[model samples]
Structure formats: structure tokens, C-alpha cells
Target: MPHLEEHVSLRPYNTFGLAVQARYFARFTSAEVLRQLLALPEV
Candidate 1:
């Protein structure tokens, strides 16, 4: 499995207009699917 850094932040790259750190992250297209996926044990 792959892992990401916990506390790194970047200012100029994220379109969300905030510097953030993600131990785990993903993008979702549907609200229902996102909720279901988040409820999964593997997530």
C-alpha cells in the first residue's frame, strides 16, 4: 500500500485556496457514493 505525508502543505497548487495535509484522500463525483464509500471498512 501507498502512504502520504501527514503534515506537508502547499500553497500555490491546491485549487481549494488552502494549504492542507492529507493522510488519506480521494475525490468523489456523487454524494451517495461518497457516503457509502466512506462507510466501507477499507476506507
Candidate 2:
């Protein structure tokens, strides 16, 4: 496996305006599942 470095950025524009490690991937079984996942705060 390849090394996964943090997804860093100088500007933090999230709700808190703070730096947070960006998520790389998300998996879903179907369209319904994807929609459910999309409703999540971290999606």
C-alpha cells in the first residue's frame, strides 16, 4: 500500500474554520446507500 499523507490546506473554510484531515474515500452498496451516506455530516 502507498503512504497516505494528510490532506493539508492553508485555508480552513469548514463550519468551525479549523483544519481537519480530509477523508479520501467513501463506499456504498447502491444508490439508496449513497444517498444515505450523502446525508451524513462527514460525507
Candidate 3:
């Protein structure tokens, strides 16, 4: 599984720098990894 980042800020990813936050975030390199993340209950 990919490393999960908690309380991630959305500013860097957004077109406009908005100060929003995410409870959990992960970066997947493959469809399998994405599926694994989707399978988690927290997701």
C-alpha cells in the first residue's frame, strides 16, 4: 500500500491556492494500488 498522508493541504494541488484540507491522502502508481486504497474502510 502507498504511504498515507494525514491532514493534507489542498493549496498546492488546486488551480487557485485555497486553504482546504483533506483528512487522508495517498499517491498510487498503478490501478492495483488504487484498488487497494479504495478497499480500505476509511477510504
Best candidate, TM-score: 3
Stretches of candidate 1 off by over 4 Å are 1-20
> In order, what lDDT does every prediction score?
0.58, 0.53, 0.89
lDDT of the structure predicted as candidate 1: 0.58
TM-score to true structure, per model: 0.39, 0.39, 0.82
lDDT of 1 at 16: 79
lDDT (10s digit) by residue, model 2, range 1-43: 2222345542455777766665544545678766766676644
lDDT, candidate 3, 2-33, per-residue tens: 67788999899999999999999999999999
- C-alpha lDDT of residue 9 in model 2: 49
Per-residue lDDT of model 1, residues 1-43, tens digit only: 2222344555555887697665555556777767866786656
Q: Residue 40 deviation, candidate 2, in Å?
A: 0.1
lDDT of 3: 0.89
Candidate 3 colliding pairs: none
Reference-based lDDT, residue 37, model 1: 62
Ranking by lDDT: 3, 1, 2
Residue 17 lDDT (model 1): 66
Rank ordering of all candidates by TM-score, starting from the highest: 3, 1, 2
Q: How many residue pairs clash in each candidate?
A: 0, 0, 0
